[model samples]
Target: MEIVKNRFLKGVTVVLSALLVISLMGCGQKTDAKTTEAKTVSENVKRMPDEMTKVNLGLPSNKNMSYLPFYVALKKGNFQKHNLNVNLSVVQGGVLALRGLQSGDFQIISSLPESVITGASEGANVKLIGTLDIQSMYSIYVAKDIHDPKELKGKVAASMVPGNGTDIQLQYWLKKHGLEPNKDIRIINAGDNAERLQTLQQGQSAVTILSPPTDLKADELGYKRFLMRDELKTYNHNMIAASGDQIKNKPEVIYAFMAAEAEAVTFIKDKANRDEVIKIVMEQMEMKNADAEKSLDFVLPALADHGKINIEGIKWAIDMVKEAGVLKKEINLDKLLDERFYAK
Candidate 1:
């Protein structure tokens, strides 16, 4: 009787051990399945497409190479890749572009820092979000007869609308050369690139600021080009701005637009994309191969690093605006700039 009891107890203990092993194996399988499921869900979320968003972007001029990054973004589908359908509006001048931005006609505008500073100072709820080009794309072009900067004194200088990028650069250049902007050399809102070139050709203005292909055209017309010094090159010539409402409300849209722009800048800087970039310039600006190549070469170095806004450059622009008498009081950098959307 004792031996039978011992055998039965041993059998019971063996069965219990087997059952426990099976249960542990089942738990391990379940945990493995859950981990796999969780990983797949995370991957699906990452691959999910962003809802398409339409964005109206205002530019001073589409024909100029300064806005090349935007054109590249559009042509290369960078904006669409980021789920942004960006529409371009040629608003003629930065001041008018900002006005369009204020009136709700445009959600964003690319213009000179001066326009932003002046507009923000005058109660326009706008912020400089990013810059397309950090350096000035402009060169002072003079009529065939005028050879010296001093000779430009008392002469009319063709520029875009007052407070435009070209206007600000022209004033800064003139001031640096000991020539006062309005007092010594008269600066007029002559018009866009072609119009300014016509003004110079018609002798309406003795000197005017010209960027790429237009400067090349000026050269062909026997006009002399005066390259600005490195100091003036630091000016934030082409900056992207948005209203306070847009920055506050639709931040995702801003991020998408900036991501596209930054990609475009990267694309432009890559030498492997040289032919493609030139093709874009030709198609957008309506230029020939050689002219487009030359324009691209001229404007390539001016592109901002991943569309990053230059705070020091902004400070310099503010001081320059104050000196230009466009802004009466100082502008707070924090209020005037919102760089959160710019990807490094």
Candidate 2:
């Protein structure tokens, strides 16, 4: 009787162990099923157009107005409309932005036409796709005491840097006014708008080239506007550019980006949207409303209308850079202007 009782207890123990294992297995299966369901649900929803193309776009921090269209497109959902995943990076200046383009850090860069031309001449395989502004909103502000560019001769004239757009303008301005670059005038590399402003304030430099916001500030501080030659009869203050390889391989992506910007341009040009435009520009630039408003008014006329590429503006830029002796080779105009993606 004792042996029989012991065997019965062992059997009962085995049965309980088996039941416990089965219960644990059931719970595990349910958990896996729920996880699978969640994954399927996540996969079913559309995922930002599957990142059809990736782009790194570069802009300068100084030209808050020049980047207004980009900000509008981002805030207003134009980029998503065209199905593009573009990453826009704010840089110190247009020259640095162009450098990012050269190193393949960014696929598209907004810079002065002169920088692009100078880069192409230096063997960087890049081309201009479209423009943001095609006229002169820039001015040379000399110390109120200095009267003329000829007076600027032999005095220290400061700009961001050589090969930079503003510097190119300075060079062109001096040349037009019959001042030789190195001989007739002394051009120094002043760091940026802030540096230029400081140099002018301290009287370290007699003249400096400045764009909007800073330019207006310079004017308020009593810096005199020296010349307005409008070197570019057809000027592009800001442009979109990419490598030749990108144009060939990812033309569709490039076109999509241009299309989004075109929509932004339209919204910005409409005076009815002035408040909205100022809000976007100010927020993106982290600037005051008053400053942003002044810059917008200054650059509005120069801004490209919707998606239109002003061929004349491009020609003017090319001509100015050529005269500055920045370009070593002839720019193929047809190869440069690619506006097929913009809506008619």
Candidate 3:
């Protein structure tokens, strides 16, 4: 409470200082360039006491490389503009992330809709309110010695925990090649993105799915790109979601957070902001100039159209998950969405 009060006070001081600076500038007294830049930044942050919503945003992934919008919202001060104070926490997998949400530890999770779908079908009552990136950014990487998906047959491969999106993707890809996942190839339980990449690099797994930056790096190091994510023609990838009752009690928080995210999305898609967004990505993902450019090229178009959920993609993903045995009984996506928070 004291911290909030102090921040609110600081915000007020910042605003007042800006007005004074403007007054001085109008009087033909030159303002310091550095001070002007500082004040300009301060005005973009919200400081209202009632609206300083604290959020425990869950990121099951280890890094923000995959969730670029959230990273932009944080780095570019979009969250603060909406008075959202975010505390981001990372766990190993979506299962642990959903567990956190169920136990009241997470206000919202940035994950795959498949994760929320799996959780909701099991009586969890979580729903994806909005999608961030609408398509699966994941591309398949194979060992240097392998050329095609078929070549991976009877080879050691890596998979995410069973019933997750990656698992489903692996199954779908193999079935397309007339191969059963478990019988035709050995899928090891690689822990996370880093683990899977290491498994592939160490020759432990012949094939694995990786999203951008990592996938870009894999390509740089001579791994074969078996397939691209967009080739699937179907995806319901990264999304933002919260529990039903939790959202009901504090709808404003969710709304403000979504608004900030949408703002970031706009910033990401604008051509004028291209250089700035790419610079941020380079710093955040620790990518070189070329890889960062490649990443922005790959993901920007695939970002949700103004952060709206793709009902078609969501439905397709649900059907695929059901076929994979992740969901016992099918449930309508309408029952799994609280559409009030995101831009509809």
Candidate 4:
């Protein structure tokens, strides 16, 4: 009777041990499955979007020649190839584009360095990423009756808009002639390219600043080109700037744009593809062949070498602004230039 009871107890103990082993195995299997699932979930997670990183391109309207490199890059899909989405915004004038950049409406503003320096002095968060034009592609045009820049003391002159690159250049030209701006010359803020054209035609302004396409228009209308860069011992233009915040976060996008831009500048400068490039320039700008030619001529010397930043040109522009009382404090020129990206 004792042996039978002991045997029954042993059988019960064996059954309970088997059940406990099976339950432990089940728990281990569940733990392994959860670990696998957690890893899978981690791998499947999506990256957070950089809401602050976006490219806003601002250029001038009507003067399509100024946008040659950008258009070439866009039409050739260079920007897209580099994994960037650039929204091209055409403003009325370069100054307006600078203002848009300052007001936070645009990310990249295309204009002369003077505007950027002025904005920086005024405490706007801006920095010049790169320069497209290193020399003066602009000329000061006056009526045929007026030859000397000093002849327009009492006469009315028009610029693209107040504080625009055109205005700043015109002021610089005026100062070079030993004339005081705003006091010696009655400078008016004509709206933009079209308005400046209208102002010149309607005799609202005796003298006006003009670029290639507009200068071609001015020539067709018989406006006299009294002064060009060849006449002045100066380098006149530069691609102004973008926000500093944009530079820190969206450096990769800027690198892509700069690389493509460098290629476009090289292509435009090549004599082999000159005609084709001119045609593309005309088609993109919607200008006549004569205007296209004029713009190409203007862009020829102003365009810098491939992927090169004009440190001297930028310094000159900054110095000019400082002299003009546009900048309140001096800035470190080296800090403004970041070439480490290209090096990488």
Q: Write the per-residue lDDT of candidate 4 for residues 16-86, one digit (tens) a residue.
A: 99999999999999999999999998665332223323568887664456567877777777666666567
Better of 1 and 2 by TM-score: 1
Instruction: Report model 3's TM-score to 2 decimal places.
Output: 0.82
lDDT of 2 by residue, 225-261 (tens): 7534355566677777877777776666777787788
lDDT of 2 at 73: 89
TM-score per prediction, in order, is 0.82, 0.77, 0.82, 0.75
Count clashing residue pairs per candidate: 0, 2, 0, 1
Off by over 4 Å in 3: 1-49
> Which residue pairs collide, candidate 2?
134-235, 234-313
Model 4 deviation from the true structure expressed as Cα RMSD, one decimal place: 13.0
Residue pairs with clashing backbones, model 1? none
Overall lDDT per candidate, in order of appearance: 0.83, 0.76, 0.80, 0.71
- Backbone clashes (count) for model 1: 0
Of the candidates numbered 2 and 3, which has the greater lDDT value? 3
lDDT of 3: 0.80
Best by lDDT: 1
Candidate 2: worst-modelled 10 consecutive residues by lDDT: 42-51
